[model samples]
Target: MHFLQQVINGIAQGCIYGLIAIGFVLIYKATETVSFVQGELMMLGAFLGLVLITVLGIPYWLAVPATLLAMMAFGFLVERVAISPILGEPAFSIVMLTLGIGYVARGAVMMIPELGTELQVLPVPYRDQSVAIGGLIIGMERLVVPAVTAALCLMLYLMFRFTRIGVAMQAASQSQSAAYYMGIPVRRLNGLVWGMAAGVAAIAGLLLAPIVMIDSNMGFIGLKAFPAAVVGGMASLPGAVVGGVTIGVIESLAGYLLPEGFKDVAAYVVVLIMLMVRPNGLFGGEVRKKV
Candidate 1:
């Protein structure tokens, strides 16, 4: 029972990691460039939610969509201003640019008066609430986290499966040159993808702020989530969630069963093992070699 309880806790934590991992997968799919600042984006989203709900006195319900939209626009700006100009540059340059963007975001957040650099709690209705299912107990945030993540994933799957825009995004991801030649607005879609990634990061932030207090350093969780992306195969969307849960479960089990410090390193250890064993990940598509 205790072990089961820990698994539940880990799943909740993994859900958060997976949500951020989705941002990694989305941006990579759209532009073939890895954004190292996803964690900072998530952190910024949380701060936006906190400000909207607490500082401005907006209701949580309204703040949710407002914050999401705002983040989406901010994401679009990031792509246009920072990422778009260097579309053909080497991947390393883009990666470093993103890292710099993240640092700027963190610094900008710290510049906010009274809110920056201060620890703050989000006003969630379900905070401290719990339910008892048989002999096991569960916190509301823990239950909600996985549930929300699952729903979001389902929505994304459907979007990519049935929507015309989804098909265009897929085409662009597969081959931007071909997609553009086919009359698709590949560059515009790239901006939209960045926006989409940012919006998703914001949603993750909103879901997570209730579970953990908002802080500038909380973005460090993105470092842990990056492993989830690698473990799941950077190109596979569904794999991100799977990798996150796997990492979460491993971390939880390690913390309980292994030495005190093993928990922090457990996720990376799994990543190393997975990379050594199956670089493609559990659900990752095979990379076809060109002649």
Candidate 2:
């Protein structure tokens, strides 16, 4: 029973990691650059939600959609103003730029006087509430996080698999020049992908805030997502989900069965093992050389 309970906890945590990993995979697929700022974006989203629900007196239900939309627009603007102009530069340049963006985001949050310097609890109705079934107890947050993550994943799968914009995004990811030649409007799709990634990150923030305190530093959770992405396959969306669950489960088991502090490094240990065993990732396809 204790083991089962731990598994539940881990699954929820893994779902959060998976949500952030999706942001990483989305940006990488669209532009071949990883957005290290994803964690900070998650942080910013949580703060925005806090402001909406706590400061502005908005309802939690309404605050969620508003925050998501705002983050989407923020993402598009980030790409246009900061990311787009440097498209032709070296990949490392973009990477550094993203790191700078992350610092700027964190700094911006901290500059908000009262809000930035403090830890906050999102006033979700389900906060601290739990239910039990079959002699096992479960937190509402544990149940909700995985359910929402699964729903989001399904929605994304459907959109990418069925929608015209999804198809265009796919083509653009495959080869931008070729996609542009085919009239796919690759630049527009890139902006949309960035917005989509940001929106997803915001949802992740909202779901996670109730489970943990919403703080400026919560974005550091993205570090775990980085391992999840690598373990699952940086370029494979399904792989992100798999990797997240695996990491989450391992961390949970470690915290329960091993000494204290094992949970912190368990994800990275699995990542190293996965890299050694399957360098291309569980779902990553064949690598190619342009030369």
Candidate 3:
């Protein structure tokens, strides 16, 4: 039962990582660049939620959607103003730019008028609430995280798989020039993809805030999630989900079963093993180029 409990806890945390990993995969597919600022985006979203609820005296339910929409717009503008201009630049330059953007985001959050580098509770209604199943106590947060993550995954799958815009986005990701020639607004789609990714990251932040304090450094959680994206296959959405849960479970068991600090490095260990075994990831497709 104790072991089962740990597994459940790990699953919940893994869902959070999965959501963030999905954000990473989204941008990668849309723009072929790994945005290193996802963590900061999540942090900013959480902070924005905090501001809306506490500072602006907005209702929690209303504030939630509002925050998501606002972050989406923020992401759109970011892509248009900063990322879009360097679409064909060297990969190293793009990555370094993303890292700089992350730093700017973090610093911007810390410089906010009323909320700066301080730990604050989000005051969510679900905070400190939990339920028991089969004699095991589970927090509402643990339950909410997985449920929401599943819902988002399904919605995204449907969108990308069925919607016209979704097919267009996929086309643009495949080749910008071809997409543009086909009359698909590749630049516009890229901005929308960035917006959507930011919105997803905001959802992650909101869902996670109740489980942990909303803090400037909370975005560091993204660092942990990066392994999830890699292990799952950066190009596969479902792989990201599976990889996150796998990493989360391993970390949970390691925390209890392994000696000393094994929990901290467990995700990386899994990544290394996965890389050695399946370089294309569990669900990732093979890539080929004719020389």
lDDT per residue (tens digit) for residues 241-270 in model 2 = 889989999999999999999989999999
Candidates ranked by lDDT: 2, 1, 3
Candidate 1 local lDDT, 175-252, one digit each (tens): 777898999998899899899889888988988888888988788889989999999999888999999999988899
TM-score of each: 0.97, 0.97, 0.96
**Residue 201 local lDDT, model 1:** 89
List, residue by residue over 17-101, the lDDT tens digit for candidate 3: 8888988898998988998888888998999999999999999999999999999999999999999999899878888998898
TM-score of 1: 0.97
Question: What is the clash count for each candidate, in the order shown?
Answer: 0, 0, 0
Provide the overall lDDT of each model, using Cα atoms, as 2-decimal numbers.
0.91, 0.91, 0.89
* Residue 71 displacement in candidate 3 (angstroms): 0.6
How much is the lDDT of residue 235 in candidate 2?
95
Candidate 3 collision pairs: none
Clashes of 2: 0
**Residue pairs with backbone atoms closer than 3 Å in model 1 (clashes):** none
